[model samples]
Target: MSSHHLVAVDWGTSSLRGALLDADGRVREEQSHPRGILSVKPGGFTEVFETLFGDWMRPLGTRCLISGMAGSKQGWVEAPYCPCPAGLSEVRAKVLEIEPGRISIVPGLNDSHDGVPDVMRGEEVQIFGAMALTGLRDGLFVLPGTHNKWARVKNGMVTGFRTFMTGELYSLLSQHSILARTLDTSAPLDEAAFLQGVTQSDNGQGLLHNAFGARTLALFDRMPTRELASYLSGILIGEELRTQSVHAAVDVVLIGSPALTQRYQLALQAAGTQARTLGAEATWAGLHAIHSTSHRKT
Candidate 1:
C-alpha cells in the first residue's frame, strides 16, 4: 500500500529502534525499545521485534531492513563484516537475509589495517548518510557514542576507521571505580572543572595517574565533590583526542546526539581543531540509501 513501508531497524547492545519508511524512504513513523539485543533472553530477537511493531506492521508485510549489533554474533544472526575501502554497493551486496530474504541485516565494516584492527557496526550508516546530507564527498567523521568512532572516507568510499571507548570507560570509572564514592552522577557538569581536566591531560602524568586527581581534588578540598564527574569527563575526552591527534590537524565532522557532540566540540576546540555536528537523522538517510541501492539491483 505504501510502497514498501519496510521496517528499518538499528538494534544495538542497549537499545533498539525501528522506522517505517514510505515509498520515498521517508520515515512515516518510528518506534523505540530500551530492551536491546543483549537485554533480551536467548533467541528473543524476533519476539522483541514482534512486541515492538508486529501488530502495526503485520498487515503491511514484515519484510524489513536492519543494521547495527543486530548483525553481530550476539545479535539475531551474525552478518559477517565487509572489508574496508568499501563503497555503498559493496556494503549493500553483503546484506544478510534472516528469513530467506524476508528480513535482512546490514553487515558492519572491518579495517584489517595494522595496529588495533578496527570494526564498526552501525556507525557506517551514519557516516555515509552524513556525506549525503552535508555534501561532504570525502573527509573524516567523528561518531561519538559509548565507543566513539573515527572513520575516514575517500572518494565516497569508506576507507577505514578506528574506535575509542571513551563513553564506556567514563561510565565504568565514574560508577564502579574508586572515583564513584565522591562523584554525584546527577550533578550538572561543571565546565571549568571539565576544561581544567582537558588542560592538564598533557602533563605527562599518564591517564591512570590523572584519574587519581579526581579523588585528590575531593579529599584535599581542592574542588567541589560534585564537579569530579565533569572533570573526569574532560580527562577521558581529552585523552581520546590525544590518541587521535591526527584528526586534530584536520576539520572533523561529528555525528551524534547534541549533548555528546557539544562536549566533543569543546575538547576539539581546546585541541585547536575545527569541528561540526550532524544529528540522529543521518542514520535514517544512510539506511534509505542502502534500501534504494539494493532495490535498484533487484
Candidate 2:
C-alpha cells in the first residue's frame, strides 16, 4: 500500500497555491505559481497545470483537493457553483476529476436576486474551517481580497454571501486610471483621512459621492498619493462593511492575508462591531477534516 497523503490547492485568478499535508493534515510542503486561470491561454490549461504540478509532486503520493477559480469556465474544466445553503454533500457532488489523482474542486457559491449576483471561490473553505474551529454556527465572515466577500453562515452551513469588487476597483484606479499616477504605493495610511472616509462612507448612501474625494484630495494637494490610496481603500472597505455589518448580532470573522485582515479588523472596530482575524490557510485544515471524516483516499 502507498503512503499517500493530502494535497490541498487554493487556485485563483493570478496564482496557484498547493500544499502537501501529512496524515494529520499538517502542511508538509507548499508551492506556488502565477498560473491562475486568467494567466493560461485558451485550451492550454492541462499543459500549464502539468508544469506546475510536476514541480510540486516530489513525494509522489497525495490526494489532491482543489478550490477557487480553477473550476471556472476558463479553468482546466468547469465545476459549477453550488448555490448558497450549500453543505458537505453539495461540495462532494461538485468534485472534479484529474489525471491519475483523486481531485476535488470546491465550488463557488452563487446567489442572485433582483439582478444582483454575489459569488465566491476558495475563501469559503477557509470560512468553513474558521467556523468549525470557533464553533460559531452563525455570524458574518468577511474575506477581504480582490473581490471582498461577506458571507453569512448559519447552522454550520454557508447560508448566503455577497461579493464587493472593492479591491479590484482599487487595483484598476490605482494602476490604469489617472488616480494611479498620483497615488504612492509606499506611503503609510493617514489616520485622519481614513477616519474621515470610514465615518462618512460607512453607509452606502454617500459612497459613490465619497469616492471622488480621492481625486479631489489629490488635485488640491491636500493629501499625498500614498495617503490618498489608503483613504480610498478605507472608503471602499468602509462602504462594504457598513452595508454588511447591519444586524450582525453575532461577531464577524475577517479572513484573509494578515494585512487585509488587520485593515478590516480596524475598520470593524471603529464601527463598534466585534471582529477577529482568521488566516486563509484554515481552508486547508477544513479540507483535511472533511477528507478525514469522509475516509476519502488519495
Candidate 3:
C-alpha cells in the first residue's frame, strides 16, 4: 500500500533492465535480460515480469514502475502517450496502473513537426532523470540508440523533439549494403575516419552522395577497409546532425551507453557543439522520481 521501495524497469524492444532502489533512490541491485517486449508472447507480460523480478517485489510497500515500449500497444499494457510539452507532472498524471499501488507503466511522449509525428517511449524517462540528476531545467537532450532522439526541453517540459534512424541506417549500411563488402564492421571506432565523415557531411553534398563515398573511398584505397565502418558511421551520424540547428550557446546532453554517447560527442564536437554524457542511472532516477511524486499524491 505504500511505496517505501522501488523497482524501476526499462523494457525496450530488444532488451530489458531492472533496478532495485531503496527509499533514497540509490540503486541497491540491478538485473538485465534480453527478453524485451518483442520476446514476450501475447498476454505473457505478467509471467515475464514475475519470472524476472518477482523476488524483489515480495517485500512490503515495494512498488514497480515500467517504462519504454512495455507501455506501447504491443506491450503488457497500453499506456497512451502524453502529448508534447510534457513534464513530470504531465507524465505522472497519465501513468497507466496495471496493478494499483504496486505496478504501473509510465507513459511515453509524442510531438509533431509540420504535421509529421515523432514518438519516443523510454527516452523521456532518461531526459527527466538527467534533469533531476543535473539540476538543469532547460536544454537540448539527445538519446542516441537504434533510433536517435533529439529533444528540446524548456522550463522542465519537453516542448518538441525529432527522431533520426542514425543507428539503424548505420547497421544496414555496415551489414547489409554493398559498402559492407569492404567494411570491417566489427572493427573498433576510428576517430580520424569518423571525424572525417563528420566533416564531409558538412560539405553541402547531402547524405546520399556522401554515403556512396564510403564505398568509393575503400575501392580507391583512400580509406582502409577496417576503418570504413567508422567512416560510414560518421557519415550517418553527421547527416543526422545536419538537420539540427544546434547553437553553440545552448547546453547539449547525450544519454546512452558510453560507446554510443562517445561517438555522438565526437560528432557534436566536430560541429563545435559540446555535450555532457549520462548513462543508465538516468533511467532509474527518472522512474524513482515519478514513483516518489505519485506516492506523495496518494
TM-score of each: 0.93, 0.88, 0.98
lDDT string for model 1 (1-298, tens) is 5546667888999998888877676777888889788898888888887788775566545468788998998989999999988889999989988876567899999996565578899999888778878888678899989999998888889898888898999999989998999998788878888889988787888899998899999999998988888899998888877877555545578999987898888888877777878986888888888888888998
TM-score of 1: 0.93
> Model 1: residues >4 Å from true position, as ranges?
59-63, 113-116, 246-249
Per-candidate Cα lDDT values, in order, are 0.84, 0.75, 0.93
Model 3 Cα lDDT, one tens digit per residue, 103-163: 9999999999899889999999999999999888889999999999999999999998999
The prediction achieving the highest lDDT against the true structure is: 3
The C-alpha RMSD of each candidate to the native structure, in angstroms, is 2.0, 2.7, 1.2
**TM-score for candidate 3:** 0.98
Per-residue lDDT of candidate 2, residues 205-242 (tens digit): 68668878888888998887668878888888888777
Model 1: which ten-residue window has the lowest total lDDT? Answer: 54-63
Q: Which ten residues in a row have the lowest lDDT in candidate 2?
A: 54-63
